[model samples]
Target chain A: MKLFKDAGHLFRLAGVFLLGTLSFLAIRAFVVPHSFGQYGHYRGAAIAEIAAHPVHFAGHQTCETCHSDIAQTKSAGKHAQVNCEACHGPLAKHADDPSIDPGKPDVAVLCVRCHSASAARPKDFPQVDADQHSGGIPCTTCHQPHNPVIAAGGAK
Target chain B: MPGVEGFMYPNEISLYWSVLIVLYPFITGLVAGAFILASLERVFRVEAVRPTYRLALLTALAFLLVAPLPLQLHLGHPERSLEMYMTPHRTSAMAMFGFVYLWYLMAVLTVEIWLDYRADIVALSNSTTGWRRWLYRILTLGSQNVSERALHIDERVGWLITLIGIPSAFLLHGYVGFIFGSIKANPWWSSPLMPVVFIFSAMVSGIAAVMLLYMVLMRLRRQPIDMSCVDTIAQYLLYIFIIDFSLEMLDLIHRIYEADESFRSLDFMVHTRLWLSQVVLQICIGTLTPILLLFLVQVTKLSVPVRKRIYVVSGSLALIGIFAMRWNVVIGGQLFSKSFLGYTTYKMALATREGLLVSIALTILPLVILWVLVKLLPPWPEKRHAPLPAALAAD
Candidate 1:
């Protein structure tokens, strides 16, 4: 009682602070999503949302099913390890309908995305200075993207 | 890849943090530093700085109120930021920001300021009329007791709060440094010395800010500037600036001596891309020039007018230097590729969401808030009509 009389203002201030904190916590409880912490850190529902999106690039096997002749030639050549979609953009629509050709990518632009000279890339990787090596011609005019054997007739 | 000069990871092409991110720490550092300066009088009993104490607190509050706006604006889902408080990931340093910010705002700054101004607020509530009266009454929080005993308790509690506030101030800015420093993936930002350097630099910027505000406000009010107060603040600024510079040099030397793989790349960046903001603006002109000017004032006997001019120039330069430091840290850290083989440019946009125009507005918003706060609080001792309790008034 004596303490309350002497320090009533302090008590009032403490009460106000407590009320503010409680209100903040109550609001937080009301608004926070229920499944937020179910996963490692982020919202678990986010993973499901992402998984529900349609797959864009069909696997290499799907391409081989249609273009077996090109696939066989690619498998026998130096460019065997590279995926079809590495140079070409996603071809889900092309694979869905055979009439859709998905047409050839711009050879210089597509090739340089990976084959451009960079010190950070692996030393043995087939890199080229797009300006010097190609001499303004498209890469496909010299070396086939699918089967690159310079001595052999390119792209059959 | 088109704009890129060398080698950058596909994901590294676009910068995640923008100019507003730079302003976030800069503003928060000012708030922490200003509050720490105010605490010097309250906790450490530095009587010479008492005149600027309330003003410093008001400055801190005004800046603190605006500090989170940048982060909010930068967020993709600003509404979702509340999850940081409700469902914060325990392992993440970013998650702790919400808690640290709340603690500093409510537990330290607001409580300290409310206690310090309680008597004046209660008195104004009684003396004023209409909406102004209601405003003061709300500010008083219904605790209108200004009796000697009650006022004495307020003083004691306010002192204790200041004591707690010193560490809180350190934590607030140091934590910001840790946010950048802890990212081991970025060699430029990864340093244990980052937080210590941030704390000292924060002190330097904060002290300079309050000092300038004191001088300017005094001039505007037609009151003679307090020489002793300005002198003390300048002295503190000089000491802290020296420490900040030393820590930064230490980090530089350590990186140079080690000469790790990242060193060559970072060294090249510092020379080529970051030369202007980092070396010339931040180090040479902004830092060394101000330090030299402040050092001269300390050593030599200059005229009052000359000393005042020097303080203004150095304080302004110190602010520029600190802002440049933040820019170099946040923006420069992003310019170099993670592979350390190439560099990219920050093409600052004109009117976009996180662009140059928005950054300038964010920077000025704090001062406008300070102006409003000054009018409302009237931090000057003479501005308040309600007399201090007889005991404190005697002091």
Candidate 2:
């Protein structure tokens, strides 16, 4: 009590600080999402909200359903493991309605997304200098999108 | 893939932390540095530096006010930043920023500055009229008593705050360093020396900034520049710069000797992409040249005019060096792919949100704030008691 009397102004300052801090903490407690940090660092409900979003990219199995011939050709090629939608944009809408063909891809752009020469890429991967190799021609002009081996002058 | 030079991870294609992130540390560094310079006079009893004591505090307050702006601007949901305080992740280093920033702002800087200016504020409140009087009155926080005993208490409390402020300043900037250093993914940023380098560099930049401001302000006000004060500050700047340079060199040497898996990739980057910014500008033009110029001043008996020129040149260069250091740490850390396979480029947009224009604006914002703070507080002692009240005039 004597300490407070001697330094009442300091106490007032401290009191102001405490009041501000408590107010901040109270407001924080009120506004923070209830389900946050339930499992990890973020709101758990966010995961559910994200999952609830409509699927955009229809999977390879769905692509295989309608275009079985292309799927068989792709299966026999070097890009057998590559998914159909990896080169083509999300096709869930096109998959549901066959009347709307997803249309031909920008073959040069799609090919170089993976094949662009980079030291970081795996050595055995089919890399290319798009400008030098193709000379302004589309990738689909020579190499078939589904069967790359046959069009690259390899065994069919 | 278009802007990318080499193989980058799919996610690394777009840089998450932009130029605004670089400004965050640079601004915070200035705040921490200015406060530490203020502490030299208050706590360390450096009488020669008394001229800069109040100005340093106000400069710190101005920059500190703007310190979090860049971070806020950089956030995807700037409004949601309040969640940091509300539901802070206990395990994350970034989460501690809110508490640290708050404590420094409220408990340390604001309180210390208020106590230091309480008597002046009370006097101003009584002397001024209309809005000015009310402004000072509100500023006094209803504690109008400026008795000798009250002032003595204020002095003691202010001294204690300055003592605490030194370490808090260290924590404020060192924590910024740790945010980058603790990221185990990037070898460029993940070094133990990062925090130490940051603290020393903050000291260098802050001292240099205050020194330059003091000279420029004195020239503007038509007051004679204090050579002793500038000399003392330059001495401190040189010493801290030496330590900062040494620590950075140590980090470099360790990396070179170890030649870790990330070494080849980083080495390539330093040789190619970072050659201009890191090597020529930061090291040669900014760091070494300033250190040499300041060193010459220390050894020689040059005229005041020559010494002043040296101080200005060196101070400007030190600031540029430290800014470059922040640039290297923040931007350079992101330039290289985590896979160590390729590198990417940062094409700073002109007028966009995190563009060069916004960065320039943010950089100048603190100076404008300091101008306002200096106008309101009038940090110079000669200007402090211009309108003293009669009752307090006797003391």
Candidate 3:
């Protein structure tokens, strides 16, 4: 007790620090999700939450149902492996109602997303210097949408 | 693409980090630098800088409080930032920021400050009445004992905390640089020297800031400026500035000599897009001018008035140069495409979330907080010389 004589201030400060540390631990426990660190550092619930979102991309088979002509043409062209929704975006709603039009995809801007020349891309991958290849003209101007290599004139 | 030049990757058109991101390192650098300046007086026993010791600590505290604001503002979901504390990724350099920040703020800066100011707070609490008395009393944390023995304990503990603080300050800013330097993909930022460069530059800016603040505050208080303090601070600033500039040049010269694949791209960027900010503002007006001015004062037998003028000019420029350095690091790193064939432009918006307005406000916010802190704790030890407000004078 004699050692603590003038160090009462330190004891009081220590009490405050102890109170703060405990409070922080309590708050951290309360705020942290129950499933956090279940699998790793992130919340386990996040994976399931993300997976629960409604499916948006109607598969190639669904598009092949009605547009067999385009599918047949694409099957023979350079884009045989490419899916309808890959370029067109999510068309599940359009598939639900054919009358609901999925407007023309901007080939000018959209084509460069994949075709832009970069050293990182695979050597075999069909890439181009977008500016040099097309200038200001759209990709659809020279290449067909359904059969790109076939060159079916410009866009309608 | 409108503001962009050359052949930027489609994804590289828009810059991810904005001006707000630039402020993060700048603010934290100030905090680190200021604490280091304060530590010189405490641990290193540099009595010449004793005049600005408390001011430097308070400046560090003020800036440290605002360091995370820019990062929080930059986040799409500011609320999720708390998750960094809850579940920090071990492998991530950035996610570890929360822990580093907390440790520096809570353990080092605040503790050191409280220990150093414990006696003063106790004295103020007993001497004053009304709201101020209540405020100081609370700040004392019921530690009313300020006996000679207790004072000795405070001084000893304060010195020890500062000794710990020196390395902690280095870690704080060096970690900021690591966030950029460790990113292997970005050659502009990826360098082993990044952390060292950041630490030295931080010291330069921090010392300059405290010096300016001390001068201006003293002038405002109608007290005679501490010429010896400013002169010593200026000398240190010059030495540190030379180191910072040399580190930057070394990085540049190494890149030139090596002429790596990314070198051509980064070089072109420096000559073109970064011409104004990097070369003009940061190196010329901001860095070289201040260093030269400080050097001149050091070599020449200048009068007090002339030296004061030189200090003000150089200090302001030093702060500007440091801000420009941060800008170049953050913005310049993002400008060049990873493909090494393209460049993009940063279009800073106004009145938006991460806009120029917000950045300006965030920059000013720390100064405002410093003002309030100055009023509350009175970092000025010579309080009798300070010009008080009517109500405060009465109290």
- Which candidate tops DockQ? 3
The local lDDT score (0 to 100) that residue B374 gets in candidate 3 is 83
lDDT by residue for model 3 over B277-371, one digit each (tens)?
99999999999999999999988999999999999999999999999999999999999988888888999999999999999999899899999
**Could you give the fnat of all candidates in order?**
0.55, 0.36, 0.68
Report residue B270 deviation for candidate 1 (angstroms): 3.8
Better of 1 and 2 by DockQ: 1
Question: Which number leads on lDDT?
Answer: 3
Measured with C-alpha atoms, the lDDT of residue A84 in candidate 3 is 93
| Best model number under TM-score | 3
Candidate 1: where is the Cα deviation over 4 Å?
A45-74, A77-156, B1-16, B337-344, B385-395
Sort the predicted structures by lDDT, highest score first. Answer: 3, 1, 2
- Give me candidate 2's TM-score against the actual structure: 0.83
Give Cα-based local distance difference scores for all models.
0.87, 0.87, 0.88
Residues A21-83, candidate 1, lDDT per residue (tens digit)? 899888887877667778767677889999999989987899999899989888988879988
Model 1's CAPRI class is: acceptable
Question: TM-score, each model?
Answer: 0.85, 0.83, 0.86
Alpha carbon deviation, residue A138, candidate 2 (Å): 10
Segments in model 3 whose C-alpha atoms lie over 4 Å from true places = A49-58, A62-74, A84-156, B384-395
Tens-digit per-residue lDDT, B1-395, candidate 2 = 57787678867877888999989999899998999899998888787888998999999999999998888887767777877777876777898888899989998999999888887888889988999899998887666666666676777788889999999999999999989888887899888888888998898899999999999999999999999999999988888888889988889999999999999999999999899999998999889999999999899999999999999999999999999989988889988988898888888888988999999999999999999999888899786653433433453
